[model samples]
Target: MLAMGEVHTGLLQNSGEISESTCRQVLGLMAGETVRVSRRPIPHALSPERLTGVDCALPSASRSRIRGVGTVVSRCAVTGGRVAQGSSYVRVVRSEADRRLPWSHYLSRPGVVEVLGKAKAADLAEGFVGDPAPGCLDMGAISGRFLDLVQASPLLDRRAPFRIPRTSLRWVAETGEPSIRFTLHTEQERTLRLTHPGPFTPAVVDLCEDLATHDWLLTSLLIIVERARIGATPGAQAVARLAPAIDHLLHLWMPAARVEEWLRPFWESLERQPGFTRQWRSLVDRVRDQIATSTLALLSAATEAGRR
Candidate 1:
């Protein structure tokens, strides 16, 4: 069995962190369903899971023709009332019959897609992480729609504190010897391949969400620093450009904060190679130095004016 998912992360449209009640109202995607909330570590709220019907060709590395039919599961999450994420995933399994099933049959098994023909897990995984051709299952688009729903809510002011592009992470997991590999593709895209010893579970989904959240934080901060033009721009001007990072993005560098214990090792391994926190700390320090230097310059000018 193989599972694939994608997550889209971006800043909430609200100017400031929103309240729990507001989060619930914004993420109320399903009628009569309660949004799950967890207060510890951070204030997080999750919309009830919704399913979307999909019948499309499954991409294969070997270029073989394969089709899958089922429903894709999706949900929206709000973290600290500042960041929003839309996550979608579907499990791939072999079908006993080689033809399309009834919509009710597919709906009965939410989040599970049945492949109608021969296929290899490795090929599908490779094709998904690699460039996918047109007409293949598009989980990224599905995830984006859910995110749009929350961002378009009338309750929100539609004014984000900062203007930054969203980031997407595509991941595939299969049961095997325990292992994980995460790769950063182009600027706004990433992919992950994992092999777990136990059966696939929802905790794996949680792990992916945590990774995506931290990855987004890192990406947003890097963009902010680049925009500041630290050395070329004037000290005060650079500090002004980076002020949003300190206010909205700096404290969100908590990696594995919401990850399950069993999946913590995956995050630890990633840290060693990529050194996510190491780079984040360096950027944070640089921002702080710029601010301090600008303050000192202002003080010096004030003193000189008084003396004159």
Candidate 2:
């Protein structure tokens, strides 16, 4: 069995960080479900899990037609009332019966897609993370719509402090020897492959979401720093360009904050090799250095004026 999912992460379209009350109001997807909130490490809000039904061709590496029918689990998450994420995933498993089951039957097994024909889990997994064919299961598109829903909330003023592109993280997890691999394809696209020792659990999803959040923060900060043109532009102008990152994202680099203790090693492995935090710290220091330099120049000018 393989569980594949995608997370679309970006800044909330609001001028200022929203309060918990407003966060709840914006993430009120279902009528009766309550939005979950946690404030320990930082303020976080999660919308109730919603299901989207799909009966489509599951992507297969061999180019064979494999049909799957089930519901996809999706939810919206707000971190520090600033970052918003829309996530969706489905578990693929072989079906006992040959043909499709009734709608109620599929609904009973939420987030689990049953394969109706002969197919290898590896094939489906590879095809999904690799270039998926047209008319295949499109988790990215589904996740994007959910994120758009939250971004389009009437309660929000749609006045984001900075305009940055959203990042998409598509991940696949299966039971096997423990290992994890993360790949960055383009500016807005990333992929992860995980093999754990036991059955699939929500903890894995939490781990992926936490990684997605921090990855977006890093990517957005890099963009901000590049656009600042620190050396090319005047010191004051460069400092002004970096002001948004300082105000919004420099403080949000808490890795594994929401990941379970058992899952910490997965994050640790990536940190050791690629060093996500190391890169983020370097960029942050540069932003601060620019601001400090600009401040010192202003103070020196004031002193010179007073002397004259």
Clashing pairs in 2: none
Candidate 2 TM-score over all chains jointly: 0.98
Whole-model lDDT, model 2: 0.93
lDDT by residue (1-308, candidate 2, tens digit) is 89999999999999988999999999999999999999879888999999999999998888889999999999999999899999999999999999888899999999999999789989998998898899999999999999999999998899898999999999999999899999999989999999987899989999999999999999999999999998999999998889999898988788998998888999999999799988988999999988998999999999999999
Task: For residues 1-308, write the lDDT of model 1, one tens digit per residue.
Answer: 79999999999998888899999999998889999998877888999999999999987788788899999999999998889999999999999888998898998999999999899999999988888888899999999999999999998998787899999999999998888888998999999898887888888888898889988988999999999999998988899899988888887677887888888888888889888888888889988988998999999999999999
Query: Candidate 1, overall lDDT?
Result: 0.90
Best by TM-score: 2
For model 1, the superposed segments whose C-alpha errors exceed 4 Å read none
Per-residue lDDT value at 249 in model 1? 81
Worst 10 residues of 1 by lDDT: 249-258
lDDT of 2 at 160: 92
Q: Could you tell me which 10 consecutive residues in candidate 2 have the lowest summed lDDT? A: 245-254
